[model samples]
Target: MSNAKSYIQTVALRDVKCYAFHGYYPEEQLTGIYFLVDVEVTFVHTGDTENLNHTVNYEVLNTILLEEMANSQKMLETVVRRILDRVLDTYSFLQTGKVGIRKLSPAMPGEVGHSFVELSYVAPK
Candidate 1:
């Protein structure tokens, strides 16, 4: 059979809230902060969508999110990069993936809602 039947499937986990210690300052590191994470991935699939095996499991995604969030990093870039890398590595059929992490109520003098970073991946053909 031709590959014409193949289609792309996307899975996303949005606004995943977590409390973790991640910041540039030592004081901020000592005190944990709330975070919001969003993960989205698209994959090529030609098989029937009848089972979890047919697509990426979101539970696994959440687990990865929580695990990465728990690990304190100095930069939001590092955290988001790790999450994106993990997602792309986990699925062999992935076409593209994106991960965004936001720090809520950052340690800043001025009124700032949040600071964030986003990382994305695209599999080479």
Candidate 2:
């Protein structure tokens, strides 16, 4: 049996809406608002079989996001960073990953659409 393998996979969370209090205004916290998160992880396969142990686990990723969502903060940037840090620390299978966070209802004035931010990280080879 060959002991080498290679694969590219992306795990993503789409439109994960949550109520958070993150803004410069007091009303932002009092009223709360909606936000979305998208996460994508890429990694190479090192095992002979397709199993949970051979690749990144999406369940764990979802759980991490859910936990982070519950722990609200003042900045999505900080939140996204924390999420990326946690993912890097928790998963050893990923070679690289990117996270995109969107604020559906920004605190800006009228007619403004959704705003977003993204961060990417690659594991040291």
Candidate 3:
């Protein structure tokens, strides 16, 4: 059988609000920082909305973002990767996912408005 999917559904959590600590510097870990996390989960829409069983829950996505941020992974890349991996693993229907995390105001001396990182994952068929 071909590995092509018939229908694809994209669920996105854009700039989901969060104020958690995640950084490498001592001050960054101590003081903590606010961040904006954006996540996109794509899956095969099997037209099973009536069941809601085969679908991914929106709350799960939000929880992953909040829980991961609270862990202080020491880098945005880690957070992004974790979120993507977790989402992909949690949902068998999920095909691909992307996570984007941006620090609202970096602690650096220079005027950096936001420091951001984006990561993506695709599950094997």
Candidate 4:
């Protein structure tokens, strides 16, 4: 257990996809868009990170992500910020975390793969 990076656990939800009406263009709201999110939190478990009480629940995070993504927002940055705020606030014990959001199919003239917005946070020392 000594060399296994024993204490720290990285709780993550990867490439969670959802449909939403969020963009800079008007048609984007009417037709909607695809949003992909990835969230990760690194922390030293107080008791056990695998346990329900000691760790952040995936369902709760999914709910938060869906609720935030449902609203018609103008920017991916706003979406990412709100998700991070809610998660970090709810799980105050987390030492550090990151939130990544991508507009999988942004409306554009040229062929654009995706628009990415990411936010990272570390609790004050």
Please provide TM-scores, in order, for all candidate models, with all chains considered together: 0.92, 0.85, 0.87, 0.88
lDDT by residue (1-125, candidate 3, tens digit) is 89856678888889887888788887788888789999998887887777657777888888887888888778788889888878877886678888999898787798898999999878786
Query: lDDT score, residue 26, model 1?
Result: 90
Over 42-115, each residue of candidate 4 has an lDDT whose tens digit, in order, gives 87866554569887887888888888888778888888899999999889888898999888867678999898
Backbone clash pairs in model 1 (N, Cα, C under 3 Å; residues 3+ apart or in different chains), count? 0
Q: Count clashing pairs, candidate 2.
A: 0
lDDT of each: 0.89, 0.78, 0.84, 0.86
**Candidate 1 pairs with clashing backbones:** none
Candidate 1 stretches with Cα past 4 Å from truth are 1-4
| Model 3 worst lDDT window (10 residues) | 47-56
How large is the C-alpha RMSD of every model relative to the true structure? 1.8, 2.5, 3.0, 2.8
- The residue-by-residue lDDT of candidate 1 on 5-119, one tens digit each, is 7678889999999999988899878989999999999987757788888899999999999999999998889999888888777887788999998889887899989988898
For candidate 2, the per-residue lDDT at 32 reads 76
lDDT of 2 by residue, 82-118 (tens): 8888898887668888877888867678966788888
Q: Clash pairs of candidate 3?
A: none
lDDT, candidate 1, equals 0.89
Runs in model 4 lying further than 4 Å from the true structure: 1-6, 47-50
Backbone clash tally for model 4?
0
Ranking by lDDT: 1, 4, 3, 2
Scored against the true structure, residue 93 in model 3 reaches a CA lDDT of: 69
